[model samples]
Target: MIETANYTAYFDKARLAGRKLNLAPAVINAILEDVALAAIANTDRILAENQKDLDRMNPSDPKYDRLKLTAERIQAIANDIMDVARLDSPLGKVLMEDTRPNGLNLKKVRVPLGVVGVIYEARPNVTFDVFALCFKTGNVAILKGGSDADYSNRAIISVIHEVLLKHNIDVNAATLLPAEREATEALLNAREYVDVLIPRGSQGLINFVRNNSKVPVIETGAGIVHIFFDEFADLDKGIGIIFNSKTRRVSVCNALDCLLIHKSRLGDLEKITSRLLDKDVELFVDEESFKVIENHYPVHLLHKAEPEHFGTEFLAMKMAIKTVTNLEEALDHIAQYSSKHSEAIISENANNIERFLNEVDAAAVYANASTAFTDGAQFGLGAEIGISTQKLHARGPMGLEELTSYKWIVNGNGQTRDH
Candidate 1:
């Protein structure tokens, strides 16, 4: 159980630690490398603790896959840490500079968003990702991981603290709060210490944080993602992209939830979705698609889609299909139901492709590709803290750069402001 009264002390320590995180770039990289090596060295221990969390969850639960960690996933997390170590730091760079007539030299420079607080669900990998990106960008991290992965998160944080202590760095640089409801409430109210709060989980969790947090929230919106199969879509390409997007990993936010099919392309729906049969993907079909695919798709997996199914994020082997008369209808449906995370169109027509890409208001819009690639590492940013669906501060996959904010630096020699 958490000593809820000590929440303020935790925030205070993290805030102070942020000041000391602006270390030299080389030193930061070295620390990250050590953490990566330590992760590999401690893989056995991490997996053991992760199993403790997994045992509590039923295998059928959507979060079960995310909560379980294996040696391969641990190695992948370690490799991503190494990738972060290799990348150039985004801190201290001059974004913009100007010289005024009054002899005032002004420059906008990149800096960290000090004391980034993340409230996340069962994905313990986020603990490492948030710490690596925040540390690389000279920011402190305060993690409020869900109780589902408490054991795993504690294990991961222990490894990080061991490395930080060895390097004489403050372990408070990456503080993991107690995994309890009281801790979450305290974090939501930590406006004085936490600069920004990021929530990564279901829509309910995101909404709770956004609605309740006194600290500014950067929402990692739940992915109610869609991929439109236009009239000009290539059968082969569409087949591959659609299959990979839905079945690659269903528990992820980027996994395809609703598939929009052009009425003209309804005939090709079976060919496009035939591969999903391998994974026993359950399809919730509309009136039109139901008629076309009812005989083709397995009876056990095929069901008539209700109104609620279109906007739902099915983090499982389930998917919904909607048939649209034209591109305009598809766009309208997406605008109505999309969470604006990742949207894609599989089409060969240049005009239709350009229109879809230009009009869709998603953080990551794709033409002739899978939505599954809506990830920071796939976009060549190593690991990501989360995918920001909001437009104000950051959008899409958040890397080291996204974790930073800019400040204006002004210099003048005896120049006084005249009002």
Candidate 2:
């Protein structure tokens, strides 16, 4: 049981230790390497434990399948850790150095955010990702993963703690909360202990964490991604991008949730819509789009999209479809409905592409590319803690640098401000 007093004491000690360690880049890199190797070594055990969890869970549960880890998934987690270690460390670097004419020397240096509380659901791989990113930035992390994958998460955390202990590092640096909802609630309210709270999962979970947590939060907006196919779009590329975005990996945060085709391209909508149907994607088409493809395909008529659908992050094989009059209309629709997570414009017109890229307020805006590329690994940041849709702190796939904050260090020769 994590007593409130115990948590407070642990946090104070952690902060003190963090100050003392002043972890250098080389030390951070070495620790990451060790953890990666440990993760690789324990892949078999992680998979077995995950399978056990899956067997006990109801197959109908949405998270049951997502929580299950295979050998390949375990290997992928190890790879992500190694990738994070290869990236540049974001600690102790001098961001700026300057001296005033009054002989005051000021230096801004990058520093860790002390302690990060990561609350996530389903995916057990997040355990490794959060540890790698946080430890690399010299921040201690307290993970509170969903209960569905409790056993698997426990196994992975045990290996990480063992690795930390082997290197004489504090094992509490990578702590896991008790597998209980009440424990999570307690942690959320423990604002004095946790420095920042990052919730990664469904919209509901993120909302709950944001609303309930007393600690500062970096909202990783749930993805309700969209793809707009302009009249000038290359049919081949647009169709391919849309299909891949919707079907490549439907069970991710960045999968395409909606597809918008220009009304001028209504003739081609049937062909593209047919292909999506082949992949079992449920289409919710607007009046114009329905009129164009209704004869050829069976689709659910969407008279009006609910406000919820506009911001909904459906991590499944479902998508909404609409037809716009012009590029302006499309852009307006996107601005109104988008989650500001990821939006794509498939147009061969350079002006349209440039406009979309510049005007869209999102973490990632794509031109001719699929919305699926809005990933940390794909963005070449190694691994991500989470994708921040908010403008403050971190705005996209948060890697090592986003895990840190800045502090100004002053060197003075008995300089005092005269009131």
Candidate 3:
């Protein structure tokens, strides 16, 4: 764990190193391939490091699964990096060109956001994803992961640095800091070196960064996601999507947190929740939805929904259910509770679907689909740092292009403004 003073030195070195490299896609791709190979080849060692962190966590703890990096998850990271490698470079591209009447030629070209900083929770995959995306986009990365994944983050960063060393590239391009509040505080206000700060994890983490950081912040990944079961929904399709969204990977941010059902479509509630019930998903239902299935099995699993339950993001085998009178009510509920991350509506009615798509304020709005598709890889953007929830700079799954800023280059021969 490096202290703040040392981290500042590292950040300075990284910024200079990144500017010197002016990385091209070929070199970045080669480095990414080596990183992927190293991760796959050293799976045993990596898992061993991850185990040290996992052993300290309670099995019932929702974050326990998040902190544990298995073979499949590691492979997914490798595959994503490979995909990013194959994509075209995002930097130095000419976005727009303009010729002024006064003989000034102006062009807007994409450039790296310079040194990017990310402060995240126990998800170790972020270590590799951040490294890959930042390297590809030619932006240096400074990472500060949660203390729970200290061993895992260290191991991952070591592998990345090994790749850099092999390529004779500077390792500071992607450096990790100590998992402490001091480091975080230093990073938040390290506007001198860090070009931008992106916080990925719980709502609390995002809020903390937004309030404390002096550097520009990009808020991501606090999905109080919702799925609406409209009256026109195809029950078979709706059931599977809801079940998958809620149960596929409950520990992730994009997993469904709330379920809104139209009053007329309450007949098949049990059918949709059957899989969730099998997984022992607890249901906190509003008055209308509760009376419909109060007599069902697993009496302990059923509970009356409280005010807090509606707005909470349950990163576990739990969800809140509320009955809505119509599309307007459903839209209103989602507007009030959504973290502006991901929202979906299961309806075949064209008008209802269109309204939902056009009005929902989330970063992603899906019709007749699961909100789980709100991912960088899933959207064909390769590995994402996180789903940006804020409106400025970027929104939705942030990819290589989102990691860049544009600068206007003007060519003029003594052109002066006329008074």
- Candidate maximizing lDDT: 1
What's the best-to-worst order under lDDT? Answer: 1, 3, 2
RMSD to truth, every model = 1.5, 2.5, 1.8
* Local error of candidate 3 at residue 134 (angstroms): 0.4
Residue pair clashes in candidate 1: none
lDDT of all predictions, in order shown? 0.93, 0.83, 0.90
After superposing candidate 2 on the true structure, give the runs of residues whose Cα lies further than 4 Å from its correct spot.
1-3, 6-21, 58-60, 298-310
lDDT of 1 at 314: 96
Give the per-residue lDDT digits (tens) of candidate 3, residues 1-419: 32446567867887887786686678889889889989998888999999999998998898998898899889998999999988998788999999999999999999989899999998999999999999898889999999999999999999999889888888888889888778898898788889999998888899999998889999895889899999999999998899899999999888999999999987778777776887899999988888888877378999999999998999999999999999999999988988899999999999999999999998999998888888899998889999998889999999999999999999999999979
Model 2 TM-score relative to the real fold:
0.93
Cα TM-score of candidate 3: 0.97
Question: Model 1 — TM-score against the truth?
Answer: 0.98
Sort by TM-score, best first: 1, 3, 2
Per-residue lDDT over 244-310 for candidate 2, one digit per residue giving the tens place of the 0 to 100 score: 9988877777899888888889899978877787777776667777777767765353234444555
What lDDT is obtained when candidate 1 is compared to the true structure?
Answer: 0.93
**TM-score for each predicted model, relative to the true structure:** 0.98, 0.93, 0.97
